[model samples]
Target: MHFSLPDIENMDHRFKVNFINSLSGFKSANLVGSIDKNDQHNLAIISSVFHLGADPALMGFINRPDSVERHTLSNIIETGFFTLNNVTQSMYKQAHQTSARYAKTESEFDETGLIPIFSNTIAAPYVEQSTVRIGLELVEQSQIKYNNTHLVIGKIVEVIVQDNVIQNDGYIDIEQLNTVAVSGLDNYHTTHRLERLAYAKSGVQPKPLII
Candidate 1:
């Protein structure tokens, strides 16, 4: 179970990738949708999405090394708009299919069995099947010197959620919508609400909220 850097470095490439990805535990599964200048749509499944800040509603995700051409990344850079759509049980199979290398002229939404839905103001498209969707405007991008990977960040400009899942305080009930999770590359999972707890204080023992 204990693996030093040398041991990890010596492991098989596929095994090492799976091990490292799984080590991050469960990650959010989303389909990033973007459109090129020609209006060709692209969708790619990514689990690296993370929240960066709330004031500007910023979020970021790690793009893999840029050795290969990434259509989704390129389109986002070109148009400055992309969407993060929650992958549900029904759409995960199609979502995973999007990872396959498709030609730049082809749309993953067309290759897979998914449909692309558009909004009035945003240039990018969203997955119509997703229960929770977010539109973001590109703000910052940083290149990781060590790996040649890029850290893509954006500010949330739009949101779409199933009305029944929205809470009074603004939390979305993901469990109710059956939003899926990704473990490593191929393994998918379902999650449940263990409990939402109140903020911990010095003297007040942390307790679960009864909501």
Candidate 2:
């Protein structure tokens, strides 16, 4: 199980890729939806979305090396808008299939059984079946020097969530919505509610967690 840098580099390509990718633990599974200038819609599954800041409601996601066509990224760059939808237990299979290669004219929504929904404020499409949906406006994009992966940042302009999942403290309960998580490239997992701890303070004993 112990693998040095040299050992890992020399291992089989697939094994090395899987091992390195899985090292990051579980990641948020989201379906990114976008539309081109011609109104061509695209939906793709990604797991690299991360929180940037709360004050501006910023979020970012990483697009893989530019070896192939990136419809979602392209549409976002072209139109300046995109939507991120949570991948729940019921739609994990259809969400994963969004990774398949399809013609530019074909949308994963039409190819798969997923439905596309729209809002008045944003031009991009959203997943109608998602329990939680986020509409974003493109803010910035940076390319990694070491790898060709692109870091795309967006500001949340709109959000749609199912009732009763968001708590009074502004925390979105993932376990309540049965939101799924992803590992490496393919495995999917369901979340369970562990205790939610209170903020740490200097001289006080910790309070009981909200469960």
Candidate 3:
């Protein structure tokens, strides 16, 4: 299982891709929703969405190089707004299908039969079926020199979550909502939390904290 840099680079293209992707372990599965100036809605399944900062409510996700038609990133850039909807166990199939290369004129919502809903807060659409939804405004973007991938950063403007899942400490119980995780490129998995450990203090032994 040991692979050196040269060994990895010489591996089959698809094998290298999967090996590198899976090396990071599980990733958040989110459906990004956006719209163009003409109101052409686009839905895309993205695994790289991550938290940037809590004080500013910032979030970031990597955008593959725009060598091809990337509807989600293009729409977000064009409109300055986007939505992230957690993919649940029930809708993951439809969510994964959004990764397909559809024409810019085609709406993935319509193509995949996923319902799109809107609110007064932002212009981007949200997945009505998702248990947790986040609306964000594009604040910054930077291209990585080595990979040509762009880091898209956004500020969270609105969040829609079921009240029951929100713990008193402000943690959302995603496990209770059945949020699915992604590994490599194609595998979807359900998660079981091992424990909620108390914050570490210099000499204190780790202890489980109840939610």
Candidate 4:
């Protein structure tokens, strides 16, 4: 369960990929949207949704160096508005296809046959088929020199979720939505909620504490 940097460097490419994939099981699928100055729109379907627990409803994702089309970054800089769409099992393939490096003039929504729904609060478009769509405003962006990756932080302005998928306890049921998670490069998986745990500070003593 332990791997040193040297050990990772010594491993084969496939092994390194699998090792990193295992380490990144905590991520979630999120579709990021932005509109260029010329009005061209772009989206990057990402599997990295980290820093979601911070106050002020913050979320972030990493954009790889080679994957830079710059439209999304430019739009965020200009308008400070973007949207995050949570992909479901039914839209998995289409969502994945949006990762293709298409021309700036091309809209991934049009290319993937996904419907673009106008956001009531934000100007950016969101995937209509997604069970959860969030309108976000860009708060900050930082570029990492090590990997040439750009880390974008956004504040959730508005949240839209299907009524049926939300539980009475404020939990969104992934199984109900048939939401899929990504593994490695091409692997997709359906997520199932196994159990719910009480908050650490709830102080509710359980007859049998089990994780």
lDDT per residue as tens, model 1, 23-101? 8899999999999999998899998999999998999998896422388788889999999999999889999999888
Pairs in steric clash, model 4: none
* Shift in Å, residue 4, candidate 4: 5.0
The clash count for each model shown is 0, 0, 0, 0
Per lDDT, what order, best first? Answer: 3, 2, 1, 4
Best by TM-score: 3
Candidate 4 lDDT by residue in tens digits, 6-83: 999999989887878777665577788777667777777887677666478898887766673456777778888998
Instruction: Assess candidate 3 and give its TM-score to the true structure.
Output: 0.97
As a whole number from 0 to 100, the lDDT of residue 30 in candidate 1 is: 94
Tens digits of lDDT, candidate 3, 22-101: 98989999999999999999998889999999999999999887522277788889999999999999999999888888
Model 2 agreement with the true structure over 1-211: per-residue lDDT tens digits = 7778899889899998898989999999999999999999999999999999999999999988642239888899999999999999999999999998888899899988999999999999999889989999999999998888899999999999966877887888877787899999899998776577788898988886664
lDDT of each: 0.89, 0.90, 0.91, 0.79
Q: Who wins the lDDT comparison?
A: 3
lDDT of model 2 at position 91: 92
By TM-score, the better pick of 2 and 4 is 2
Least accurate stretch of 10 residues (summed lDDT) in model 3? 65-74
Off by over 4 Å in 4: 1-4, 10-19, 68-70, 201-211
| TM agreement with the true structure for every prediction | 0.96, 0.95, 0.97, 0.84
